[model samples]
Every structure is written in C-alpha cells, then in structure tokens.
Target: MEIVRGRSVLKRTAVGRLQYYEKEEPSVVRRQVEDTERELSRYERALEQAEKELEALYERALGEAGADSAAVFMGHRMLLKDEEYRNSVTRAITGERVNAAFAVETVGDELCRLFLEMEDEYLRARAADIRDVSDRLLRILEEEEKGGGRCGRGPALSEPVILAARDLAPSETVLLDKKKILGFVTEQGSANSHTAILARTMEIPALVSVPVAREWDGRLAAIDGEEGILYVDPDPETLERLKEKKARQEEAARLLLEIRDLPDVTRDGTRVELYANIGGPEDVEAVLGSRGAGVGLFRSEFLYLEKETYPTEDELFSAYRQTAERMGGREVVIRTLDIGADKTADYFGIEKEANPAMGFRALRICLKRPEIFHTQLRAIYRASAYGKVSVMFPMVASLWEVEEAKAMALQVREELEREGIPMGHVDLGIMIETPAAAILSGELAEKVDFFSIGTNDLTQYTLAADRQNDRLDDFYDPRHPAVLRLIAYVAENAQKAGIRAGICGELAADPSLTEVFLKMGIRELSVSPSFLLPLRKRIREICLEETENDQGV
Candidate 1:
C-alpha cells in the first residue's frame, strides 16, 4: 500500500478504483506563412469555433451543476473575447508572418506567464484559465487542419473511480461525468483554483498537491478528505475502515438536510436570522439550496473586478435584479464597491500605498469618486422594485463617511424619481469593521437602518494585525475580548436604535463561538451557504436560558 498526503479542499471520504486522467496536448510548430491575411482568417475561424464550444459547455454546466460552477465557463468566454488578447494574437500572426497556430501558442504562453507573475491570488488563478482557453483554440485549429470532425471526447468510465490528474482546468472538471467520478486527487492546484471551487460546489471529496502517479491507475484506493490522505492499494482493513467513514459522512449529511427547512432558533425559543454571503448573482442558487433566509452580504465589487472597465448602471441593474428575483423577496444587502486594498482592478488606477489594508479602500474610494458610487446606488434602488433590497457601505470609520454615502444614495433615489423610474424602499446600512466605527456605534446607529460587524477586518484592525499574514495567526484572535466587546457594543447600539445588528464575516461561521455571539445580542449570522445547516443545528442545541441562569441574570 502507498500513502500520500495533500491539502484537502472538502471534508468527505471516498473509496474507489484509482484512474489516471490523461489529456492529449495539441502540438504547434512555428512556420513561415506567405498569406498573413489567411492566417488571421484561420485564427478568427478557430476562435469562433472555440467560442461556440465554450457556450455549449456553459449550458451543460448550468444544467448539470449550479449557476456558481457554470459561471466559470462564462468567465472563460469573456477572457476569450477580451480585446487585448485578440489584438495580441493578431499582432503576432500579422507582424511575424507566422502560422495561426504558432502565433496563438506564443501569445498564449506570454499571457499565461504574465498572469502567473501577478501578485494577486485572483489574478494568478487566471493563469490556469488563460491556458485552458488557449488549449481550446489550439485543439480547434488542429482538428480543422487534420480535416477531421471534432472528437467526441469524454473520460471512458466503466465504473465509479477516484480520478487522479496532474491538474485540472475548469472546463476539464466540468465536462467530467460527475456520477462516474467518486473523488479527485490532483498533483498540482490550490484551494482557490476553479477546479477546487467546482469540486466544493459539487460536494465531492478533493485533494490537491498529491504526488499521484500513473502506476496507481486501476488500483483500489481510499480517500480520506478530512485528513487529505490518499491510500493507494489499501489493505483490506483500511478499505473497510474508509467505507465505514464514508457511511458516517453520508449519514451526517442526511441529518443536516433534515433540518434544512427548520427555523434557526434556540431551545429557549430565541430566533436568529441565518443568511448567506455571496460574491455574485451565480451564488444565489447555492444560498437557496442551503435554505438561507436572505443574503447578508452581496459583495458588489465582483462586477467591477470581473470587467476590464467600470460596469454600467444597466449592467449592474441586471445582476442585482437577477439575484433579487431569484431570492424570492428575501432581503439582499448589497455592499457597494468594496474594492481597493486586497481586491483591485487595474482600470481603477489605484496607486500603491505603504499600508493598503487601512489605506484608500472600500467607501473611501466611493466618496472620492461619487460618480462610481452614484451609478451603483441607482442600480440597487432600481432593482429594489423586484424584491427586498438594501445597501450597505464598507470601511465606515467616521460619521461623515456614512453621511456622505447616504447623501449619494438619496441623490440617486431623487434622480430616479425625477426620471420617472420606478423603485422600492431601500434601507441604508454600514459595516462596523473599523475600531473607530465600533467605538462610535451609538451615534452611527442613528444614521443607518442596520449594522453588520465585519469581524474579519474588525479583528485585524482592533488587534493591529494583518488578517492575510499567516505569521500573524497567533496574534490575530477573533475571539479576543477586545474584538468581542466591539461586536457586543455594536449589537447593543443597534438594539437601542431599534435596528438589527448581524455578523457577516468569517467569525460568523465559527460554531465554537455560537453561544458567545447569542449572549452578545447578535441574533443574525451570515456565512457561506455550506455552513447554514450545521450552524442551524448548533443554534437549535443551545438554550440561552441556561447561560443566563449561570450568569445570575
């Protein structure tokens, strides 16, 4: 038996025969071409064919998987259609007088390298996407050159197997017959890769960075996803143990589903609102599947980061409207343009700062650029006509910042009304992520309808530690009394002002602190959709009266 360890992407177990996945790499050789025009024409034709294939893949993914997984193909399509990429390919073919295939290979390699060199994790992950799209184009050109019809290709599976690969692109992962695939172990990939995201969304066991080999193909294997271990040609005892573990995992999942439709309340009859945090409209399906009451944090920066340019009001409205309509009248608190700092778009042209974490980010960018903030407000308000919608401002440290953001929202509403545009009631809120905001929550509570404590930043800012810095793990404590006191203060201030205060950060998902939050008067928790049921189970088991009695209340 051979044992290997890797990073786990999901906590599940699988026992099956190991199968190695091999993809044919299309060969491209640089050759001189007499007709540059013809080469460009061939490139355009291949691009068209590749685009159609991606569109078909998107449809398949949308039907088989949920919108969140399907959105990767849409992103691939956008990268395919990007003007700079098209122009780069054109320049290579026409300027070098090279064959279309060679031009694509060279240009694609250069772009992939550039993306990989980027410091941002999001941009770096795009490197795999670039390679995926490039490979697609090459395959199309190869098929056409060989005068053969496109190969009807799929991994031939006679039975369920643990698929092992060097790495998997989003397209490759999505195209696999999921039912025949028991789990995945890749020699290379990160948790942020599209393959990992798809695996997580599918609720499948996945291990990345495993030292897999072709020799293990067809061998009986057991995957312990919780421990990120792969046992190849496992002993009979180990196989039996893994099977038992798999059964227990399945049973646990079934139990969680039993409480999916139940109210998120405690034994003492204290009701807590459980919502989901989403980055885009595509995630709404996951929220609904997990039975989230509403969207606590609709991160609006995705619209900006995904596009090469600023999104139009109409474009923003379409996304928001889609999310609201799908939520079926559930409240969607849209946080306006929380970009800069860790998340940034080149189009914004934000200059580098010594301290970006606390520097010009979030609402600071919005206040400086009122036009951008105004456009987002218009879209949110317009979408409110379809369902319950609210707007929140992030990184709000001072009262004037909240007042300025509110002023812009009011201006957008008035302008829409003047233009005869229909709208609905849109409540305004601010995030209590800054220590200054928490300290002055009593006064700030009067200006906003609700408060959502962003504990990720609150803990970082309060303790003077960078949340992203791994070395600060020992110092950056979310449960620190100082951080909890701020959260309690914000919740108390909200209660006095007759407004709801919720937590929409990583801490909200920590089941260990569930009772602590409940005792702090925080009755609402917004977390990743996958955490909904487990947290609901924890809340149901808690009796707040017992804590009160222990405290001599």
Candidate 2:
C-alpha cells in the first residue's frame, strides 16, 4: 500500500473509491467585433444569474453549516457586482467584441494571474475563487447559447467516494451531492480558508494540498483525516486498521455532542464560560451548536475588509443585532474595528508601514479616524439594545487609550439617545495583547469591565518575534514562560480588580494548557466554535487545586 500525506483541513476518517476531478481552465481567443450590443446583454444576464446562484448558496450554507462557513459566498456575491470587475468584463466584451463567455474568461484569467503571482499564498488562493465564479458565468452563457437549457452540472458523484480535486471552492462544495460523497481530498487549498470551514460544516474529513491525490483516480483509498494520512490502495491489513480507527472516530464524535449539554464547570465546581470567537453573524449558528455560553470575541474587522466601500452604520448594526439576538441573550462581545497592522484597506487611507504587524492598525487606525471610529461605536451601542452586547477594543496598551475609547463610546451612546434610538445592556472591555497592556493589567483592569487576553499578539509582543513568520516559529511559542507569566499577571490583576478575565486566542483552544489556564485563575475561554466541546471536556477533567502551587514557568 502506498501512503500519501496531506494537510488536514477538517479532521475525520473516510474510506472509499478515489474520484479524480480534473478542472478544465477556460480558453478564449481575441477576436474582431461583430455584435457588441448582444455581447453586453449576454454578459449582464450571466452576471445577474451568478449573483442569484451565490445568494441561494449563501442562504443554504448559512442554514445548514454556519455563518463562518457560508461567509465566502458573500465575497463571491460581492465580486459579481464589483464595479472594477464589471467594468473590466464589459470593456472586454464591447470594446474587444468577444462573446460574453470569452470576455468573462479573459478578464477572470487576467485577474487570477495577478493574484497567483502574489507572494502571499492567501492572496493566491483567491484566484481559485475568481476561477470558480468565472466558470459559473461561463456555464450560464453556455446554457444561454443552448436555447436556455440547463442540466445538472456540478461535481458528478458516481458513488460514495473520497472526492479528489485541485481545490474546492465554497459554492462548488455547497452545490455538491452530499449523500453520494464520503469525504474530500484536494491537491491545493488553505486550511484556514472558507472552503475548509465549509468541509467542517458538512461533517466530513478533508485532506488538502495532497499533490499526489491527482494521480489516485479509481484507486481504493483509506484516509485518517484527523492525522492527514492517506493510504492509496491499502492492503487488507491497512484496511482493517482503518475500519477500527473510523469506528472509534465516529464514537468519539457522538460523545462530543454530549459534552455540549454538560456544564463547563471544573470537577471542583468552578464554572468557566465557554465562549466562541466569531468573525460575523453567521458564526452564531456554530456557537449555538457547540453550546457556547457567549461570544468572547467577534472580529468585526471582517465587516470592513470584505468591502470596497466602508460598511454603513446600519449594515454593521444589522449584523451585530442579528448575532446578539440569535445568541438568545448570551453575551456577545463585539471587538470594534481592529483594522490596522497587516490589515490595511485602500479606502481607509492607512499608510504603508515598514513593519505592518507592529504598525498603525486596529485601535491605532480607529483612534486616528474619529469619523470611522464613531460610526462603528454607534452601531455596536445600538445593537446592544437587542440582547447582551459588549464592546472590546483591540491592541490596547495604555490606560489613557482605554479612557479615550470609552469616552467616545459614551459620547456615541448619548448621541444615539438624543436621536431617539433606544440602547440596551452595554459593557465595555479591553484586550490585553501587548506587553504594555499585560504589564499594566492592574491599572487597565480597574477601568474596564473585563479583560480578554489575545495570546496570539501577546506572545509576539512580549517575545519580540513575528508570529506569522515561519522562520521564527521556535521563538514565538504561546507556551513560553514569558507569555504564560504575562497571562498569569493579567489574571491576577483582573481578580484584584474584580473584573471578568478571559482568554480569546489560540492558547485558549489548546487542551493541554486548559489546566494551566484554570490554575492561573482564568475562568473564561473563548475559542473557535469547533474547540468548544473538546475544551469543555478538558475543563471538567482538570482539578484547579492540582496545579495551584506550580508557577506558570
């Protein structure tokens, strides 16, 4: 048996026939004009059809999977209507005088080439999304050409198989026939990409970036998605081993559902709030499914990043309100526009930084652009009226910054009340992600209602190492004594100040460190929705008294 390896996007086990799906790239030629008007009309119709399909997919994925998983379709829908994309395609068809299908193919390939040429893999994967959407447009045009006929066109599953592809786009995955599919293996994709999130919602194991998967067509394959192991044409012994492994995994998943209903209390009877860190309103579904008590961190920056224009107050308010109301009164802490550092938007006019990760971003951008800051604050405050809502400022360092942010929020609250807008339960908090914030936790905690330690940033700031830099990973340990010491310091200070102290970072999701966090007097853990159940299980098993005397170091 040949063993092929890949990166695990969503961990699960699957054994089935290997189905190779070779995607055909669109090819078009530059031709002379014959009928520009017909070409433009055809292009418009196809674009409209693509938008309708994307919206339907979004509704379906949102209902079944969760908002986080479905969020990628929203971007696709936005791209369909993007002025730059539309204008480019229109010019290609009208000016260049090509068929609508060819025009779309031309524009899409050009844009995808630029994205693929980028140094960042995240940006490069975006090319696949464009390619996916372009194919949708091409199909619409083809059907139009064929007397408006439409057939069942998607991933054609012949059997319950481990589907192999170059990559699975969000729309493509949603449109797939789920009953006939056992799992998925892709030659290229990002684990953190929305496609991975979609795979999790489908409750199937996915192995991605398997360069050899493209060759395993028609072979019997056994996969351990949990460990990213792929057995190509396994021997009988390997097959039996996988059968046992699959049974254990299925049993483990069934047990995890029970953990959701179980209390997130330690054996010693100390209750900890098991919360989920979300990106947008759609994630509330996963949070509820995982039985999260509250939302510890809602990264509001996504609302800003996904658009060419700034999101309006109403747009931001609706999203926040939806999440708050959906949680059914559970606390939803909305972190205000944390859009600086590595996340700069062209519309925001944020200057390029020599060191973006440590530069003008998040709170720095918000504080500078008072108009942008005030708009989001008002929306968040307004959303509070629906259910339990709290505001969290990211990258906060100084007590004065907290006071300034708090003052602006209060000012916005009064402005809303003056305008006859009703507001509800509002709690303001600060994130202790910098060394300065950790060191000044006692003073900072005194002013805020709570403290959420963002370990991803705290570790980087404290250790002076870039967390995203692969070469420096050894230097960027979240379990480093210094990082733990800072966390311990914050926990102690929050206790002294009688404020709620929680962790909403990658550290909070690590089960091995669950006991360590509880020992530090940290009672709230905000993790990814998928981690809620596992972390809860770990929490219930640990006795805080056992690690009571051990220093974090």
Q: The CA-based lDDT of model 1 is what?
A: 0.86
- lDDT of candidate 2 over 1-553, digit per residue (tens): 8887887866678899999987654345466669899788888888878877877887787665655566677667766776677899998877777777778888888999987887654355567778778888887887777777542145778778888898777776776778888888887665645677678767778887787556688999988987888888899998998889899988987888887799999988889999998888878888898899999999898788667789999999999999999999999999998776545455776654546777788888788888999999989988989999999999997888888998898899889989999999698899999999999998998899999999988988888876544346347788999999999999999999999999998889888898888888899999878789988888889877656645453
Residue 277 lDDT (model 1): 86
Candidate 1 per-residue lDDT over residues 282-358, each given as its tens digit: 87988999889999999888777667689999999999999999999999999998887657676787885656787
Q: What clash count does candidate 2 reach?
A: 4
> What lDDT does candidate 2 reach at residue 481?
95
lDDT of each: 0.86, 0.82
